[model samples]
Target chain A: MTDINFKKIIRIGLIVYFAAIALFTVGTLSRLKDGSVFGLPKFLVYGAVVLVLTVCVLLYVLHLQKRLKSGKDAFGLRVLRTIHKYRFLIEQLVTRDFKIKYKRSVLGVFWSFLNPLLMMIVQYVVFSYLLNFRGTVEHYALYLLCGIVIWNGFNDCSTQSMRSIIGNAHLITKVYVPKYIYPVTKVLSASINVLLSMVPLLLVTVIYGLIATPKLYLSFAVLLLPLALLLLLVFCIGIGFILSSLMVFFHDIEFLWTVFSTIWMYATPIIYSLEMFESRAPWLITVMQFNPMYHYINFVRSIVLYRTAPTFLEMGITALISFGTFAVGLLIFKKCQDKFVLYL
Target chain B: MNEERKLMISVQDVTMTFRREEDRSGSLKETVTKLLSRKLKFSTFTALHDVSFDVYNGDVLGIIGRNGAGKSTILKIISGIMKPTKGNIIRNGNIVPMLELGSGFDFDLSGRENIFLNGAILGYEKPYLFSKYEEIVDFSELRDFIDVPLRNYSSGMIMRLAFSIAAVVEPEILIVDEILAVGDENFQKKSRARMMELMGGGTTVLFVSHDMNQIREMCNRVIWLDGGTIRMQGETKEVCDAYRI
Candidate 1:
């Protein structure tokens, strides 16, 4: 086929792909609005979201077509191509990280499995016994474990990625690999850790469900745990991209982020129940609603602890926050990446 | 001089600038004080000043310059490690830059592992590295220490491993920056021979070196950079003789 014909076909494919997603999103949104999925306000917030997304995607596709005419791939396509091209390098880096992380440690890779469980135990004792958060949350161990696993993944991924650029100054200054690879590998390694930790999380859920509850808390809805975790992983990668880029220019961000993330962890209702804030400070609950982790943690909790699928609104919020952060973070990273070598 | 010879790399009007902070303080307190005092100072150093050059296929081009003459900056620009402050570079084919050998090596990883890791970092496919794995180990002559951690390897041993991993890749365009003098005398001769072999195999080689003898012997064409500008560029004998004087 001629180059023009090939370009035309790809342009059409792009349009069709986006159009299909828009249709699917609209169909799902209408079903959700009819209260078939889950009960909520009749307002068409999701419809508006789908429409805006469709418009944005269409605009981008148009921009991409223009670039195609000029014999250039789209920015997103170039990014994907770079990732595919350097997949081996990324794999090696992640493996290097995993190896170096566990080197000289007695337990080694098992630390990934043990760390969250240990943190949950400490928090469980502190909150359930000392702080009187026992009756406040049902299946307190499971609740605390779920929150810790998700929060730790985000914390480790972001904090480590923040240092990835500077830590690999030798490689960055000497080599021409994609700058995003460092932060991305950090997130991937952290995600692997999260996946390993989930085994223990699930084991605890099963044991706690059988002993503490009349019915098994485990349900078919727990199958959606992967989707929830995938969203959280993408969200952490996005935050990683943002923080890593910011960290390149400002050294203070490294120290500042430590304090900020600790505060952010407490801000999210990880250990405390929202009900605890309902009486003391109702406004805090309203504020916590804006926190993306609050939605993500709640989404995971709804499936694992409550044995119910998340509400359509909850799913929509999590998806929006995750993808939105990812888009923003990618843009910031790409814009600032070329200058990173200078700063480093 | 052949009409069918392709332009392997076209560097046009490329300029690189580095902004150095007068007071190198990275903390928040210093930043805040500087901000309040209104003395946030930056001095810009232009490393390359509108430099332009082109390399054709299978041409052994040597760039000769003193330190701070922007020899490394131009190589970096062509290699895509750093974006030039002005203009651009268009490179065709898979360009392998040996800017610093084993730049991505992990001290905790074994010699065998570093070979693969360093190969991948240099943009070599895993299968190719696998095929050449023994060749690399044999060339580096570190068979006994292949499984030992890199920290345990001597610096010369590390250099041999790095050079071996890098040398195996048959890139269309190879960028070398004064990394020829690696390892002890024996390994150095072996490496130089290996480099000569690579340059002989119809690859477009862009070499930067201060060694007049090496440049005179190896290069078909030479570009002399002085103060970030091409002071002279022509046949190796003409430019090298001029540069020598």
Candidate 2:
């Protein structure tokens, strides 16, 4: 990377970190009014702030990395030809994944939906009925379903993409296609599963009459769900690029993600409500607001539950964060792509 | 038709190096230190050194060499699979390199699908491949197993299918590595006949192999590479005679 580009990314990283911290501090103080110092509210706020800052730093590092490597981009006529060639390659790989994964299986693709439904059943059985959870059963199911499904999408896409390049290390070394195409293909493949999982969630919403708010017809938030998902996919793309590249040098990244994701699942308010800690833990809610994925999930939840879209500010932050994540992912993937050949 | 013709491929001053440990003996402590020290014992082995050659269109040039003589490296360099440490490869037409047989198959994909997939990798668009699909399947004699996943195919069956697809996708220049060695003798004979047909259709072929008899029988010109440099470039008999030693 040139000194100028490196400096630009560093400046952006520092600004985001400081901005997130400032917002968390204000949000934390706002929550502190109703509770004692060092209470649950304060911990939640600080925890959420840390999550947002960590994501920002990770993304900026990926961005700086991609900018440093110079050989990846195809310059002139080669670009068009490469696109033409690799498009088929990516398509074929996706088809291979699809065909190979469910080959000779009964229920084939229905299992995509079945897997998430089974998880929902477990959650419903445990939290809603068995434990007699404090929240309303239907509302809890709706909330948990929304968060778990989206989180699964992000988790599956990132983990699969991180391994996509390494798993296809044979092809990457022998063939000349740009390396990013592998992870991009994995994202596309997992998207098929993600789309499948959404069906059950949508059905539950309609059947339960949970989406009854008139503002739900505002259509902007509804329209923004797909847009938001696209951004999130781009966000995963960026994360996938960084993790896959890092996994080459440190084989531990794949294992680390397994543990990290399990912990992250609890950090987001999947089983619990933001309200549980809002008055008692306002700072936590403010900090979670900074997490792009958290914001995305809540944005979807808001449209479904509250019937109104995220405020212009929330939508703006989501867009900016998603775009920045994608840019950085591309940079990291491009930087480490060449080193792959040597390591192999 | 005569001796004077347009050159199709040019290779200049190419070199490749591989590192190996040095043969230095010492006391146990000294040996251990020498192995781990910053100034470690090592040696540089050059696979190819200052190699240069050119082959013209309509010239069936065979590269003859010993096992470690950089023959494969030269072929890989011209095919754009491997970059040379210090040289340039200027080619005039599309190059199709058959470095290894059935290397591109995704075991999950069927034989028919892999034909399309391999064709795409070799630069064939979908429509053209679809049109030529029947011919490839027929030539491979793999019609019965066409829809079966490649993982189930025997080695010979896979080679036949892979070679058939590549043969049908006739590029302007064909570079065949020693894939013919592994297939059955019948398939080898079939491959020779198919190569003859490809050459008859005006494709330039640079066939690389260690077999001197095949080189003499197949190529009009032969370039013997030894220690990464061209030892001789002349008529097949002349070069193969020198390479036979």
Candidate 3:
């Protein structure tokens, strides 16, 4: 029974991936060299905006990383040992998340696709009519779709990862697992959801006559997007490990996080294209250049919009920053994890 | 001390304390004051203090304690679920703790799925558990409902299933924490027999319970804990008698 379900879920994941690829191809081809794609030639002002956003994100990551490192085993191999020690518990929570989240829901996981699709339509209507925005309908729709889907992955991962450790306070206090695995699972679940949301992106692209292209298959670089998101997720998890552990003793983080997520949403280039400020904003673009999330979004845009591989420079920078932040985050989270039981 | 009886578990000079908060008022000023004072103003209640004991392989060491006596805390420490505030515990075997059967089981999952899950929680690998699947189902007598989700199971059914899984998987050291009280008479008989089989083998069993009769019947040696201290440690009947008063 378990094997059957596992296979079924994997099949669903594959189908979603395939569908996303086809959709991205069609969408990119249709919008290629068309005057409709917000027509910003290397949006300089937008770079400035993303640069500022990047600096803030980097500062936040560094601040939290410092706080976590101030405790024991600053490198945090001890926490990794703890995770290996309680691998079973992590597996249990993963299965629990699967069962509890999907119980009695008819759409089951199809809601993953349905959710982003519905959001796309609603946003299209609101932006097209309420704001009186005038971009090509297809461009606006596809841009919003791509951004929203990618943001959904990020939002779901970070938001869930923030609560991942705390939400399982019962397990955290009672059972010992690597404190990072819970947050990792939260990120993975959101990643899966993001992957599923690609289905709608595909269906919409097909409607616009953007079918298969050599660039479409090359979209496999999108898989690398998770690696970057994972770094962010790790950064969040590490921060979560310290914050949530502290939150157990002092209970204000939940409320603080709700507001932080809102600010974080605007901080990322999800709602608007990074091209919007390219020519006008210099300092902002410089700051945005440092924003890892900007790179994360651009990573997606490179695959879906630009129809080419992400430049080695972008990939190299993202890889270095992401893995570094991820390692630091893990170290911090592990250093502070043992303090949780004492605080509780 | 019998030198020939090698110690499988040693609880030496263990002390556990918990802080009792005095106020429930919600005030930033109060919190700030507490922070400024750099003192939590907590009155420490010792849950276990200077407690020492040892058990050998194949010994069923029952712990008899009154309601506030820290029996379960001892189990928790031994199980590695909770850390001791001080002292050290050296356990020399694979400890399969039935701290709370079904504690981690997701109610939405089917009985079969939960068995594998709960088995893993108790430290059994998936393939090993799958091999013993038929035996577990047969022992629990829940074959017909194996595929049904656990939330639908009655308390007896839950206990039966949980007990069966724990008992079926033979561990080097088994700590049973007051699970017998919930089982029906038939299950009680089955569990008792299973416990006897485990004790008769090389598995060291640390049984914690309030039932004196069960302790007297099952344990060769007993320790009675009172208010975080062991008041008596000796033969099971002697300790039980001391605990009764």
Measured against the true structure, the TM-scores of the candidates, in listed sequence, are 0.89, 0.75, 0.76
CA-based DockQ, model 2: 0.18
Per-prediction share of native contacts kept = 0.79, 0.23, 0.21
List TM-scores of chain B, every candidate.
0.96, 0.84, 0.87
TM-score of 3: 0.76
Tens-place lDDT per residue, model 2, A74-111, is 24324444555566667777777777778878989988
* Residues A61-88 of candidate 1: C-alpha lDDT, one tens digit per residue: 6787677678787776675456667888
Best by lDDT: 1
- Label model 3 with its docking quality class: acceptable
Give all candidates' CA lDDT scores. 0.85, 0.73, 0.69
Question: Candidate 3, A151: how far from true, in Å?
Answer: 2.0
**Model 1 spans > 4 angstroms off:** A1-80
Q: How would you encode candidate 3's per-residue C-alpha lDDT over B10-89 as one tens digit per residue?
A: 99999999766666323445677876987656677899999998888778899887898998888878877677889999
lDDT at A168 for candidate 2? 74
Ranking by DockQ: 1, 3, 2
Docking class for model 2 is incorrect
